[model samples]
Target: MNKLSVKVKNLVIGGNSPIVVQTMCNTHTQDIEASIAQCKDMVAAGTQMIRLTTQGLDEVNALRVIKEQLHAAGIHIPLVADVHFNSDVAIAAAKVADKVRINPGNFAQVHKDAAVQFKKFLEICKENNTAVRIGLNHGSLGEEIVNKYGNTPLGMKEAVMQWLSMCKENDFYNVVVSLKASNTVVMTEAYRLLHNAMQEDGMLFPLHLGVTEAGNGDQGRIKSAVGIGALLKDGIGDTIRVSLTENPVNEIPAGHTIANFFESGENEILLDSVMAQIRRGSSKPEAIISVNSALCGNTDTRSQDAWNEFIIKASCLFGPLLLDKQIDDFDAVPNFSHAHNHDHECEHTNEHSSDHESNDAEEQIFVEMKKIFSADRLVEFKENLMQAARRKFTHPEYIACPGCGRTQYNLEQTFNEVKRRTAHMKGLKIAVMGCIVNGPGEMADADYGYVGQGGHKVTIYKGKTPVLKSVPEDQAINALIKIISES
Candidate 1:
């Protein structure tokens, strides 16, 4: 079987090459500046390639302008034009862009001369020395394949193979294949099956990886990471894109971060940076307010009512700040308390004195907050927090096993603590395993890990590379932390 290996400009896409991370621009192609600005920004943030929609003549004209501007700026990164329902646009884009991405699912269904249209499109790409991405989306699978195989992994793989065969038949070999399904399991399974089938058939076609309609930032990123990350870990994917509903700018970073994980094995550092930014931004108080109102009820009920009133007043003060900053779920506030530990002092203090002190304390707290968080700084802080919250899977990830009777000291507890402490740290995976029996294998890919042994001894491994043979249980966390922090 031929190994799947293909090159895009200077970057290789398969056969032991590091997976390429890519994204598409959502900006209107006619708005050249906006689209180019976004493309440049994504490129700067480490996106390996950019894809843009070239739907009609207007978009094709825009592509030419955008390509000229990018070339002038010395950005020679590959640009792919996504074409659907139109082969002419594909031909036009092939003239300018470095690559053309076509959905065979739709293109093959176009007309009786669909194959001829595709052949013409391939000829244009070949003349331009442009690569072609045979993007096969599950949502648009060919009717015959779907009917034959019920839209399962087998069906998806068949669809891809059919298109790949067509490409070969037309003597178009500068091709990459992508089989995408919104369902993660289906996506993963389909790719695995396709990889095996291609290998068996002795086909050497590079694969494009993605989960289409991956929803919003948070959920979409997580799903993409898991699906694509798993495949990359297994040496399956050649190029990858994380589809999201959010801004295209956001997609670039997420793609780069994932690529960075495999390229440098530095996911922990990325994860930590994201977490720290989240913690810092999350710690800020949304509001501080002074409220004075008489309550008519039993002491407990009156206290509850006063607390509710205080919360309402505080939310009113902070609501605008939250909205202006685009912070979600800002209405939820952290708990506050002013209780003193010394009961004796509280008893000795006069009731009137206590009331006066409480009022004074509230005033002081409000004043202190105002002093620390000026409006400008607060806005900046919120901006930083939002950036942190933005989904970018550039962190060290772990797949630690839960401890069992093969066991050691509180594996779950240690795992939680390590995760908490390293939450703000990125690109580091620390596995806390129950025993050495299966621990080493489970944590083989982990950057740093501790596998428990009976009676206080544990084995530590780093980056699927074994380190110290054994260490005491009590010292494992510190040792792991030190190694991760240093790394």
Candidate 2:
């Protein structure tokens, strides 16, 4: 692919440059102050570019004011004017804005001079040396293309190709192409196919990425991340936006997160792994505790105090029991036989005579809990709880396993019941793991959970901490509900 050098302020799109994160302002562009303030917020949050809707002359008027304010503040980020329906707005915005985005499907005339008028708009943009973006949305495809190919990825791609062809025919190579769809699967698949097609044809058009109308907050962020993040992993997108129904400023963070995925290679650890790791205990001892002694170089008092408190609580819960040889070496420990007998024996003896021990079981339990409850562990537990709570209360999240004969309850049925009951919640996470062997670890991050044990028995946890065990099968949901409600 040839390097792209379409200038937006001082930043260049495409080529070896870092991915550009962009978002559209949700405020009425006619309100210059509101639009300028929102743009300032987006700039502060690391947005590389911003687009404002330019419906006609009135919005164009606001654009002029916005340009003045941006210049006064010395903010030089590229500003794109989003135009539709009228070529006049596009022509007018090209006079002042950094770039002008046009939807070809709507930029038409009802008379014989339509083509002439459209050419005039392009000529004006060319004269001003402003770049153009040919943005094609699946929701607003031209009637001819939709009728020929239906509303599939193929149709969206065709619409974009047609626009690009027009730009090429008119010698407008300073253009970007975006083929967007709201469906995550379609959006991702279409971009992949189009990207390949463009490569095969030697078309080096810079691609702008987005998933349109992606709801609000977590849902929107998740959908955009999955769609845009996937393409970015393959080195396909050059610019991106996260379209949400909420405040436009919120979109800036989401865009930056996606861009940073490609810029820093952080998405490899972020996707499908953050939640999983939170469920499984960390492999490193340093991950288990977050201490702030001068030796460790931590000076934050709040973090140090939190670490101390957690250690105290965890030690209190498990300290005495671990000190008892019988309980410490019990079969409950997974892979007890895998360790070298000498090492296992050493671990057992160390716990028994350790300074963490107490004569009283209750006191020992608290001490043990505290020892295990370092700041890192506490933070991990809280993250898990928040994820489970969000899933339980909001969307369809599952806690299934690699099934075995020990399983009694229908895991799928339990999952559906919990999801249905908690769908009204905005941020609830519930887990339904199969058996006690792996249930506690699997449901460690859930806000409320149910794990099937032997016949008719279930264990419940509220955010990694076990609240109740051995509740009968019939009362599991009710128990979980009560715990979640109280929490």
Candidate 3:
């Protein structure tokens, strides 16, 4: 079924439009200048839409000024207000932001009250010609939905469908919907279920695809690519956001890589070739053991962007197969030949000498293999890939939010600390969240969580129960570590 397009300012999402890539700002919305600066950076990085954290009325007012300043500077990029647990804020933000993102599950306390508030918010959105995203996360499903569907993909679909029903009843169509999860299997399956349900209902709203709480670095990228790529492969996703714990600007290039790979029409040739390779590789036992030159496809791993592109391609190729249980493990190490560029070697070895050390062809192969795909590096990548696919867990799975204005603490630094300290522990889903608003609920599946509370405090949780509350910011990590160790 053809999806209905939702327009946010000059950007059109869904229908026959291109897959738009977007990112959210982490700067405090109250700091209008910093928000504006971040917005400028995000825009320069090719972000189609920008979402800022809007937690209260004060932030809404700040958002107004930020948008005004951006427009005055000739940047008409659509600004989205990400509102959670507040209906009134969502309504107020609709008038100012080009789009308003709300998770209806938390719009109000009571389910019925949420419906009423959501309707009121929709009325305002319609009046102001603002786009809406009925964004729902797997870990944040409402109690009622969880009661009925056990917090599974069905629950997510059922919850979002309720809001979509309200939209249909109210004749509101300028809306996009998302069901994000950190687990690639859950994320992809949820979207697929929702897509089929929408098709059955005879109206398909555009999907905003993402892997929520996907942590930083290569794992984040691979996990996001796997989840979002699976959905896009089935012609499901409309707009994509590669959420990372690092700088939001880094998200744009990663998002674009995934978007470009699955883009329709002209890119279909590349997509088919890659998909065919994945299919062939996953089918036979012999194919599974080796990662040869052909497995890398035509992507030349010699340029500046080669490593990043390879990560995207590798995830896209192997993720689906692993997620679907077609292959359990790959035995042999990938040994793609490095391009014979001495300059690239110098960049790595930091050697200015042109006449470098001499080596035979066999010795050179060993050197390249050791430098690029060492045994330890291969194991790390495999473990992460396995964890991303949810097939195995050899290391602690980190679920972290990309810091937003609500994040009062140094989220990136704190999360890294949590990861470093907890690296030795295996099979634990540890979450290092930014703030209390959505942290506890979003990290519902985590065995342990480190949530930031305001006023330089932190809350430690053990499976939805607050084990330690109001620990000092400096001591929170130690407390969390102790709790995990004691358990």
Candidate 4:
């Protein structure tokens, strides 16, 4: 990934810079005493940056006081002014704040003369050497983006792109960007989309990541992990603020924990939000899926009880569960377990009770992922998530287990070889397995199977029936591709 270095006061972001953990103060900004105390606490808690809300003119002076007090106390972390609509306040904040965070959607709405306002805003930021973050959110994307792409990830990306384009026009390079959503899936997918687009355009401004309106407690922490963790694993983020609906101080630890976990090569670890909204308002899901989120204990030299605890937590979440298939904001990679039972339960294999809703959901996932991962796993997702699988898969459907000791051959290498050759072919179900006993049975819905027969040999199946027995491992890749193309 291409990295860009951006200066916010004394802190530099991107391009070999350490991922900075940030927190925002929940206290009213005009309350200088409370703001100062919180800022001190945040700085003490290892916060790299502190964000304070600047809602009006009064808060502008408040920012100055907070900065002065923090500086007096010898804390020099960059202060970011979180401004929504008031560019007047934003301009005042730039004079005092190290960085000014503006919501482009609301900023656009408030300033009808966007060109003039942005030009002035950029001039002030440049004059002061104050950085800016052009943050966009799903709920606040304004007329231009909503008109073009609706309230979706693409809209969020285009919204930021429009602002970034304006920043370029004004010769403003001290800018960061964020596209935040409460749903981890939506948030992660949005970052991936924007990253690709920016990389293609050679734009590598540091990115600020967060899950907006993520509610309190364990759910908040797990969600913060899933959304931000996904991108960090992909090496896409520069700074992060885990927006827990709790004390801002709690957010620091959560954000830093996520950073440290991803940094230590725990990339594949997933936290299960279980795709539930906690039955918001009066609305209720027909059934309840109870999943207590867990993380592998954070230490070296822990007992196997730690590993046992990990399995126990995971098993309880997915145990004896059937796919009620509650799709979250996006097609998140986290696998969850949920049992199905309720008054409104209906059985229809191919269709949900609500076709329009399902179509909307499926279409949204398809359009979003098409931008982010089509070259990676978009093919498999199209087959599984969208209904296109019923018509004909546009990509190969692959299944492989993390092999065990009973396995006869090297499943990982063989699976890779098979996939490498036939990844271009569509509408084929291929299975690669470690052991022969459960392997063939597990290939239940697959169109073809490649199970280990013995050392360096593979059994190729046409549907459920074995068509070729004990083919050489070297010949298996060609054999699988040949069968798919021929069939």
Local error of candidate 1 at 130, Å? 0.9
Q: Rate the local accuracy (lDDT) of all candidates.
A: 0.63, 0.61, 0.81, 0.64
If ranked by TM-score, best first, what sequence of candidates would result? Answer: 3, 2, 4, 1
Instruction: Report residue 444 deviation for candidate 4 (angstroms).
Output: 40
Which candidate order results from sorting by lDDT in descending order? 3, 4, 1, 2
Model 4: how far residue 17 lies from native, Å? 1.0
lDDT of 3 by residue, 15-63 (tens): 9899999999999999999999999999999999999999899999999
lDDT, candidate 4, equals: 0.64
| Deviation (Å) of 12 in candidate 1 | 2.5
Worst 10 residues of 4 by lDDT: 287-296
Compute each candidate's TM-score over C-alphas. Answer: 0.55, 0.58, 0.87, 0.58
The number of the candidate with the highest TM-score is 3
Candidate 2 lDDT over 1-487, as tens digits, reads 6545477657788777787888777666887888889889989988888888786788888888898889899988788998756777788999988889887655642224545666777788788888888887655666777689876788878777766676667777778778776555567767877887777777768889976644443444555665676577678888998766455676776676557545765444332332343346532111121121231223332343434333322221222122221122111111212322322322333453443345542233233333433434444333322232221122434333322223457654665577578766655555666667545643424566677887788888877777898899889988988888887
Q: List the residue pairs that clash in candidate 3.
A: none
lDDT of 1 by residue, 72-111 (tens): 9998888888775578888888888888888776676665
